[model samples]
Target: MKNLPLSINTLSKIIGKNCIYVDKTKMAYQLICQPGAFFLSRPRRFGKSLFIDTLKEIFEGNQELFKGLYIHDKWDWSQKFPVIKIDFSDGTLKNSERLDKRIYEILYDNADNLQIKLNLNRDIPGTFGELIRLSDKKYGNKTVVLVDEYDKPILDNIENSKVAAEMREGLKNLYSVLKGQDAHLQFVFMTGVTKFSKVSLFSGVNQLTDITLNTQYSTICGYTHGDMERQFSEHLDNVQWEKLKYWYNGYKWLGNTNVYNPYDILLFIHNRMLYRNYWFETGNPTFLVKLFQKNRYFLPSLENLVVTEEIIDSFDIEKINPLTLLFQSGYLTVEKTFTRRQRLMFQLKIPNFEVKIALHDHFINAYTDLVNEKIGLQDNLYDCLEQGDVRGMVQVIKRLFASIPWRNFTNNDLADYEGYYASVLYAFFSSLDAEIIPEDITNHGQADMTVKLANHVYVMEIKVVDNANIDDINGDDVNVIQHNNSALKQIQAKGYAEKYRGIKGITVHEVGLVFSTTLKNLLNQ
Candidate 1:
């Protein structure tokens, strides 16, 4: 087997060191051949830095590195331009003063590389402007500017509004210099995870073309299906291809083809093809969890959330939508898009198994008081489902509800609705990485949830009883036992389990759960 370029980000190093590389030079050449500046927004660990380094090598006229690449003959080797690269992903930038110092240091390093001296008594914008003009003058060619993680400074302080705003202004001041130095610039590319408005970040640079959702370049930063088959065929042996696609593929922009997560693929291959949450485990979603809790977002709705193009693209510090943040941050992707009366609409969902399982794990932690016990609960739940123990599953669920503090139910409005219980149950099953379908549809009606195991199918119906609406049976109120029985009867009456009857070698199990507003524990099972 060939060596994988797992940690390599520099184009020259990958090419010179004989590492495996997916050919993206043709797309890179096409991007540079176009006119005007460009901006691409993709999630982190999506090969943006490697692409930036490839552009750097191309503009610096490193023709030897392109020997076996598509851009070898297409690009002109004699016409080399001076390159100015800036990477904001390096160290922490907590305040405005640190941001200014970092920009000046980068500019000074570029000037030194081109054998030019810059005046030390200027602000960041002034120093940057001088560096661009001087580099162009010395190299006798228009300079190419490439910036990586341009939004990191602001994103680092996103939780703090005042600090984030200050960082945004500092970056805006530095970027505003690009407009005046356009005369000496040949090409410019800026990449980041989030897309702040042009008026906020790129203030006066009005000519920037955002190709974030442009169909033509949608596969610019990821591996397509053809890429995996052709470039990575050597590692396909003994690997479950369908499961690989299900876990890592399905990330789409506007193109017909879906893209796979490069980081996950590399780690999967390196670890002897053992499937795991490689990329999702690398970062914590604390901010996202806080946002969801603060906004009281319905977690189940994330599977098929609808929004307009304007809503997804309109991200600012003053008004941040959790859905938009989730979409831009790669937790959710566009499952479908359509035009409704001249307005573009999208249906977004969790991208793949890796995201679906990991995100819900965090959601379970944030929603319930079982912070340290969630993993054990998830394991027990998975074991019970695998063993076809309906009674054990019911007991586990009862324990889950009993663990919730009393204040959680009374203080939050979400607890008043039946959907809240269903959502929590969905999160529990989903965290185990089970094949779950919420609101599973059948010819007769919709089931609350369905869990599919290897040899069994679990069809569940949940009912929430109001304290005031208890029925009187034989002069006594109908207890939780009757309500639970009613739920199971309704499932059978609607033929919810009949839909799976045709499948061979699978046993179908029916479960009915009822919760009373007055009683937090499981009233019926």
Candidate 2:
């Protein structure tokens, strides 16, 4: 209940900033025991930077920050160690020589602080090994090395293979410096969003414990339930709890740990708004748009996906493999992991809703044809729900998908495309969520679309029009509406509409759309 202070160096000083110094009293303990070398991987903005900052304070022996906090009285903060923090959050490797220059600059900067100006020329290894040997003369204690965002280079050019590989190699060279300096390094902690093979960076640096999967340190990166309960309980009512969960609570750490996104959670509680995809824009993002497009991924039912290891284990950067990357990076998490016997097997669900629609806005961009419709999807569907117009709602979707550039999708892919379109619609109907079944089974068998909002259920039949599905149907049935008698019969025989029989108000609408056509063409047909 005590107030936080505002000093930059003192954790206590971070007052009025929603500062959460989760009694890392245990950090002091951890430092005493496993103080040798450590590495952590979590998604960006999950508090890796803040963790390092806190360590800097602790190691500096700033007892002021610890006042009344767990480490204050418990620690023998009597000794402050010399710290050398290397932040890779901004540095990059574009050219071979430039990377070396950046490496030399980092070494030179740290060395200059100790007043040891040496000639950092071409011949020096410039590895962490060489730097530590040079710094040992000036500082009494072994250095505490903190490298943040260590994978920025690799992330930057995931789309550009040549550049990504170049960056990877350069970073590998720079990290090579860390090897063999174990003698001079008292503590080493590196943080990244990836758990990349150590062979990529530290080939010789083994025995570096990966604390990422370690449940004990799970709260070390993001806000835990207890942290929120203890620190943010009062602010809970400020925003819709369901919306909060829908947007940010999907990430899981350890086995059972449910963690909230520190970035979104803080901004949400801090600003008190339920806005869309905020963090994605602020950072350098290549986006999962292409990935979604390639996988023919739907925006609505992504949350319900139970991914196989084949689907989730690996992905290419340009592909935006959301399953792999999101889970690996933290946007999506192991909501549940199924195992057989004692061996690890497959399948994962979206840990929660916070990340369900992370790809929504990204999809809009990827589908080039979908830009300019800034409709948050959540808003429009809810608008129709409030009006209780089942027919109008179906018409809205009919018109929505009808406007897309369908050339990108084939006839068979129409249902899949419409699934995403409906999912977007579902997102808008946030308030009436329980009613809408994304891939609902209706009287027609499986309705390509069935939306139940505001106690009204609508059964929809969507057929894709192209040279293939439509032209042939036109030839067979001669019906202007559904094409062939076969098409109409299939809809009737399957009983796709039967499922919606008693759901309050029921409406049936059949719509056939040509997505790639222009507005003029769409309006005419």
Candidate 3:
């Protein structure tokens, strides 16, 4: 087997080094056939930069690189376009001024590479347009522009809205030049982790077609199962194929195929097939988790989310939808698409086991004060549930709820709402990679949550009561509460566990939890 190429994204470098190349030139040829501005959105490290580099090589007429590739005999080798490549994948742009400086540097580098002298005195926008025109004029060919991580400047400051908006406008100025330079451009392709609304960032370049959801080029970036079986079979001989797929392969784009994240695949093999959260560890989703916590997002809803196209399409700096951010950032993926009332809707879900575990683990950090101690508690909780020790599970969970710092509840309305507790439970269970259904629908009613483990299924109902209303009952027997229309009584009365009772080899367990706002912990379990 050839070298994995690891983090090497340069097309020429990979080919020259005899590394494992997935051969995306066919898609590149197809994309280049259409001469127009285009945009693609994909999660970071999903081979977007490599795809951009592939396009760059193809347009630069590097015919030798295509010797064994699909586009070798298909393209005109003599005609090479002046390639102007812009990459924002490196470093952070704190404000508009820093962004402009980076743009100037990029333009200078491109001009120097093409051996064209740039007029330093021109404004940033003028300088950009001049670079395009001069490149076209000097090379006797229209420029083919390719941009990678076009939104990184903005995304780098997403936690700070003001700086992010400033970065947006700054990029808008640079990208705006693309529209006027359209006459001198042969092809344009820009890729990023997130897609900003046209009105917000691409108003001037409105003609750019967004192929983010286009099925034809859905496999343009990322590795498919076929790519693995054909290219990396040697490296994966000892690995369990199904286990590997379960951990890393489920990302979809409403296309015929689902692809695995290349980074995960490379590292999984590099690390001796140890199934760790390699790709996820590279990113910090603290902001995303904070957003979820602030919004009190129901954790289990992510398992089976249904949203309209507009919801997942694009977001502006003025309004960032957590769901869109999640989907665009690789935390969530499209499971399927269906039409609802003449509008397209998508069913989104956590892509695979790695994400389901890592994402919810992050959520747990944001929801509770367990911090680094969560692993032990999680193990204890899992053990209890695995052994069907309902009482032990409740005690572990009570410890979990009790671990939350007082400040999380002080002068806050979190304890008054049952969602806080449910969200916590959902995160804990999901972090274990258990199948969890929030608001589980049954014939009688919707259970607060349903947790499905190896052979045990837990049907849970949660009730929140202000401590002031039950002051006298604080130290009373929890069983007494169970007898008086308690959460468990509600489950028993409504028959929430009936749906899972008859499943072969599955034992259904009903559990009820009562939380006290004043006590800031479970009063009964």
Candidate 4:
């Protein structure tokens, strides 16, 4: 089997070294054939940088590299254009001054590579504009500008609003120069993980087309199912194909073909077809986790987040929605999209098992008191469920709640309602990577949570009673054991497990949990 292109982001290197290359040249060709600036937004590690590099090589008239690709015979490689590529993934830009310094260094490097000299005293925007004109003049052809990770400067400081705004303005000024240099540009392409509003990034560049959700380029950056099977056919032995798809595939922008995370697949094949959370493990989403904690985002609601096109496209530093951030950052993907009354609407979901597990694991660690021992506890919980040890499972959950620091409850509004505990249960069960559902709908009503094991289905309903609420009940009737029994009775009375009544070999486990605000423990199980 050929070697996987693990962490390789250069198109020329991949093609020249005979690495596994999914032919996205058709899409690349289509993109450049049109005469306009373009922007594509995809998650990190989704081949955006490689795609940009491919465009650079193509426009630089490296026809030898295109020997067997789709665009080899189709592209007009006779005339090469001057390419000015800038990548923002190199350094940290904490403030506006740093952003300016980085941009100046990049512009200097580009000029140096192209053998052009520029005025040293000018600012970044001026230097950038001069570089474009000089490159165009030197080569006697229009320039092709490629900006990779275009939003990195602002994104780097997103957690700090004051600095992030400064970076945004600095980038905005630099990008605004592109509008004026349109006459000297043949084509311009900018790729990033998030889509900041054009007003902030592109400002006067109204001609720039955003193809982030355009169905035509949906498969541009990631590998489709066909691409995977065909490109990596030699590595298929000893690999679970269906499980591979379940773990890494299902990222969709539009159309029928779901794109797999390229980083996951590359690492999977490189590691001898092992399945793991390769993509999510590479970067820590501490900022996103902090956002979730601050917003008190209901963790379970991420499965079916409904939003409109405007919401997805309306991502700015000032108005960051957790759902939008998740979707654009590749943690979540569009599960379904449709037009409702002529307005486009979408339902977003975690893309696949890799994301589902990794995200919830991080969420559980951040939202709950479980820290270093979460993995061990999760493993024990999994074993309990597999062995049908309901009491063991209850003990695990009780221990989890016991670990929560009292201060967390005081600060979080989630402790005020039953759904808060339900959300915790959902995150915990989901971290196990089982076929679990939150707020599972049944014939009578919605169960708090449901877990479908190989031969068993666990239906759970959780109820939380604050100390103040317990005071309303009679002194003799308001015991924790009574509330627990009431919970079990409600589950049976409402026929929560009736949906699986006639299932052939599957046993249904109906679970009832009641927590007391005063006791801070599981009142009943």
lDDT of 1: 0.84
Clashing pairs in 1: none
Tens-digit per-residue lDDT, 1-525, candidate 3:
699889999998998898999988887888888688899999989999899888888888888888888999999888889999999988878989889989999999999999999887999899999999999999899999999999999989999999999999999999999999989999999999999998999998998999999998888879999999999999999779999999999999989799999999999999999999999999999999888877878777887799998989999988889999999999999999999899999999889999999988888888887788899999998898888888799889888887888888876799898888888898899888788888989888899999988899999999988644455345457566566437898899999999888889988899988888887777766
Q: How high is each candidate's TM-score? A: 0.89, 0.76, 0.97, 0.92
For 15-47, candidate 2 gives per-residue lDDT tens digits of 335455556557545754445788787887776
Model 1 residue runs over 4 Å out of place are 383-390, 405-414, 417-419, 434-480, 483-512, 517-519
Q: Clash pairs of candidate 4?
A: none
- Position 173, candidate 4: lDDT: 83
Candidate 1 per-residue lDDT over residues 89-180, each given as its tens digit? 89889999999889888888888888889999988888999999998898898989999999999989989989999999998998888899
CA lDDT, every model vs. true structure: 0.84, 0.58, 0.89, 0.83
Q: Pick the candidate with the highest lDDT.
A: 3
Worst 10 residues of 2 by lDDT: 516-525
Q: Candidate 4 at residue 445, lDDT?
A: 89
lDDT over C-alpha atoms for residue 89 of model 1: 87
Off by over 4 Å in 2: 1-20, 25-28, 78-80, 91-96, 115-119, 122-127, 134-141, 199-206, 233-248, 272-277, 284-286, 295-301, 307-320, 345-358, 374-394, 405-525
Where is the poorest 10-residue window by lDDT in model 1?
Answer: 468-477
